[model samples]
Target: MGIVIKQSIKNTIITFIGFGIGAVNTLFMYPYFLGEDYFGLSGYVLSAANILYPIMSFGIQNTLIKFFNENNKTEHELNSYITYMLLIPLVFIIPLTGLFYFNYDTIAAYESQKNPIIYSFVWVIPLIAIFMGYFEIFYAWLRAHMQSVFGSFVKEVFVRLLISVLLFGVYFKYITPLEFIYSLVFVYGMSLLLIVFYANKIKRIVLRFKVPKQSKAIWTYTIFIILSASIANMLLDIDKYMIKHYMDIDNIAFYSVAIFIAMVISVPSRAMHQITYPITAKLMSEQKWEELNELYKKTSITLQVIGGLILVGILVNINQLYLLLPKEYSQGLFVVFTIGLSKYFDLILGNNNAIIFNSKYYKAVLSLGIVLVLLIVLLNMYFIPHFGLNGAAFATLIAITLYSLAKLLFVVLRMKLFPFTYKTIVALGVVLISFFAFYYWDFSFHPMLNIICKSILVSIFYLGLCHVLKISSDINFVMRSIFNKVFKKQ
Candidate 1:
């Protein structure tokens, strides 16, 4: 766990810094600088592209991690394997490119029925999708080599920083709204290039046409994962995409702000998963069930503790935080609460995704993901027309809850492993207690001050309780280490 902790802390810091910049962009710059309509348009374009990139990449990103292991493969075999990873995506990318080129008018018309402004940006979707697809493939390549920090920085910090600069460009009238939208293609393209350069520096990618022995299994997993990845991405971005059908494009911007607030709860999980994912894959590959289960439990509680603090902090300070946003944007309060809760549920699952994806029963889980995507789409279809933005949040919460439970049950039943323990219950107790304790009481200070004060109170109360109850020894150790260092310096 030494390397895990060391890297996770670094990744956590990096992710938070990224989210900090992202918070500014999502919360302030996009709203104020670009105005709501273009902000929503930008959000819509990116969401659409996110939904498409998995199919374009053909799941090579995840496949790389699941398969790459130095213990089992020679350098030649590894090169052949990576060569296959590179080529498989072209099989999808080329056909999709041709389809988009020929049928773009039809595609654009269908998507932009409610918002004609979206039609012009439709071509950019596949272009950015191509960039995003390759970026993840290369990022996965780095993670396979257990070198994720630089890639994490590139993904989390670098991309958001570029968005900030671009948003400022829009602010100063240096870039037209359309130019700003088009610049996204260049931003993601440059991002992919940076990751590719770093990946090459780690190990020069060599092309070898020799087919790996596990070609059969590899293709099978890739096919299922492509569908699975597509479904997963759809589940995330479909609400934003579908919103255009039921609501104004500006509503997407409102919904995105709330979603971004909720998404901060996921940063710790994202940071930890970068390191833990490949580790989980290796553990499962080695058939080290004991260590695997132990890791499962530790990661669950640790993330629960960290994610819980963020969730509690957000929920308790939500009202004051919303006060800081434009009055129109505050309509997403329920969206924040609902999606924040769902994200917290997801965080507590620890490396559940990594475990399941690396397991043999992945095909079954993929089926569940398909059902979830359909369910979410149907729910959004029915709910959005009636309840508007909150309805989308409701649909996501329900779909995520049901899907998370199903995955948990499948893992327990199939593998006889569980992520919960007595500590989990204690951690939940701490979270609930902290929320109830601080939520009803707020300083009569400025909204920002109220949020800062309330957040500090919530953090102290929540983390202090965790320390007392010992919800996660890993967290407690870090807390103690910080305290010891502070006192020593004094």
Candidate 2:
């Protein structure tokens, strides 16, 4: 818990810095500098690549974490394991590359049916996908060694800061829109290189051709992971892809802005997961059920308290935040609310995903993910036509809510574990009370100042209530430490 708390707090700070930069980019630069059409095009290209990278990596990223800490393995066996992780993705990447090369024009034509500018950038998808795939692979390698802060910095801060520079290049008339789009390939490639370098510095990656004794289990897990991961990514990015087909490309940009706001709620979950995932894997592998259940509750409440504050802050200040955006972008307010609620639900699940993925019943969860993807796609098709951007968001909310519930039930029923207690209920109460209390009480000032004042108010009120209620001792401990440092300085 000490290392988890220490690294998670560091990762949280790093992630916030990254998201701050990202908020500037997503909320301001992309919209104003690039214009809506190219912004939408950029969003489309990235979404399509996100959907593809899971298959390209062949699930080696996840497999690396799950299998890396196998007990009683010699140095030679470990090297062999790492070697297999390195080489397995080539099985999918090579064939896919050849396929894309031969049928490039036909695929481009299909993608460009609704949005023609997308035709020229079609080839960039697989190139960036390759970069993203290996980046995750190397990041997972670091996580296996219980080293994630540098990778977090690289991923959360480094790549985004580069993108900001590229955005500025466009603003200063130095790069064409097409060049900016193409520059993303270089950005992701550099990110991959940095993570790979850092991973090697931690442990030199040696390639040994000999397969481990658990080769059969490894292959089985990898195959399941590939299918499961593909389905999961589809559930996330499919709405954007569907939007490109059904709506104007500019609509993707509008929806992306709202989605970005909603995504901030998940930052705590993301920061904590980087550390908890490998720990969850280790515990399950060792069959430490009691310790695993305790971690489950602790992570759930901790994330809930942190994530709830973020959600409440966003909801209460959503109107003022939108006033800062272009009028056309305000159409996504419902999108923000709908998706924000869904993301909050996901945040409260703690390490539910890690538990399911590492458990033997992972196949069942994979089947459930497949069904949810189909459900989301169908809902998007039906709703986007009738309701537009809000429709896509609503469909996502339904699918994600159902998906979260399914995972929760599967974990509880199968493993007889749950991630709730009285504190969970108290956290929810505090969030709801804060939202209702501050939502309609905006100050009569400039929108930026109003947001600042209101956000501070919400934080103090939210954290104050959490402290009084003792919702999370971990969070309370952190708060006391900060106060102690501040008063000592004074």
Candidate 3:
């Protein structure tokens, strides 16, 4: 737990800093520099590429982490395992590349009718997909070695920092919009090379032709995870994909701003999961059910409280946030609330997804994930045409809520592990009251100043109350540590 907390804090700091840069890129720079169509095109390309990333990697990113620490093997055996992980994805990626190549014209014809900007940049999708796949391949390599912080920093911070510089180049008229889009491919390609270099720098990877002795089990798990990855990608990326279909490509830019704002709440979970997944897998492998259950509840409570504060801040400040953005994007006001709450729901689940994915019941969860993807797609199809962007936000909110609840119930029923308590109820009550109290109260000042005041007051009140009530041991520990350090300095 000490190592987990230490590294999680490190990763969390890195991720939020990255998100800070991303918020600038997403809300201000991209909108101002690229304008809406190109901004949306960038979003569309990335979202579409994400949809293909799972297939390209063949789920090796997750499979590597799940199986890496299962047992110790000789260097020869480990090298053989590396060979399988590296080469197997190409068996899937290459053919998909070919499929995209041959069907390029037909696909472009359909997409251009809806958003012709997609036509010029359609090829970048497969290229970015391949880049993303390899990036994760190396990222998981470092993660399996329990060196996640550096890799996470590179992925979260370095990549966004690169994007910021490139967008500024576009702002200064040093590059055309089309070229700016192409530069993104270069950014991802460079990121991939750096991660690959870092992985080798950590431990020289040796790829061998021999397969592991558990080749049969490895293949089965890899296939299952491939399906799981596809399902997961669809849930996360389908909204942008569908938005492109139903509305102008520019709408994606607006939707993306709201989505990014909402997504800030999930940063803690995202940072924590990188370290927690391998730890969870190790615990499950050791059959330390008690420790695993304790980890589950602690994560749930800590994330719930933190996620609650972020949600409050975002929702209460959403108006001022949109004020900073162009008027065109201000339409996504409801989009932020719906999507933000959905993300909060995801946060409170903690590492439940990791727990389920690493457990023996993974296959069942994979089945449910498939159903979730289908539901999300269907919901988007149904809701977008009738309700517009808000409808898409509603679709996501519904799908994520139902999907998370289902996962929660499955874990409870099958493993007899419930990540809930009297504090869970109290935490919910605290969140609701905080939201209602500060939501209607505003100061007569500049919008930004008002946002700052409300955010500070809400955070202080909410966190102070949580501390007084002793809602979470993890939060209390963190706060006490801060106080101790402060008093020591005094």
What do the candidate models score in CA lDDT, each in turn? 0.92, 0.93, 0.88
Off by over 4 Å in 2: none
| Better-scoring candidate (lDDT), 2 or 3 | 2
Cα RMSD for candidate 1? 1.1
Model 3, runs deviating above 4 Å:
none
| Tens-digit lDDT track of model 2 for 77-123 | 87888888888999989988999999999999999999888999999
Candidate 2 clashes between residue pairs 3 or more apart in a chain or in different chains: none
Q: Which scores higher on lDDT, 1 or 3?
A: 1
Ranking by lDDT: 2, 1, 3
lDDT by residue for model 1 over 171-241, one digit each (tens)?
A: 89899888999999999999999999999999888888988878888899999989988987887789999
Q: Which window of ten consecutive residues has the lowest lDDT sum in model 2?
A: 70-79
TM-score of each: 0.98, 0.99, 0.98
RMSD of 2: 0.9
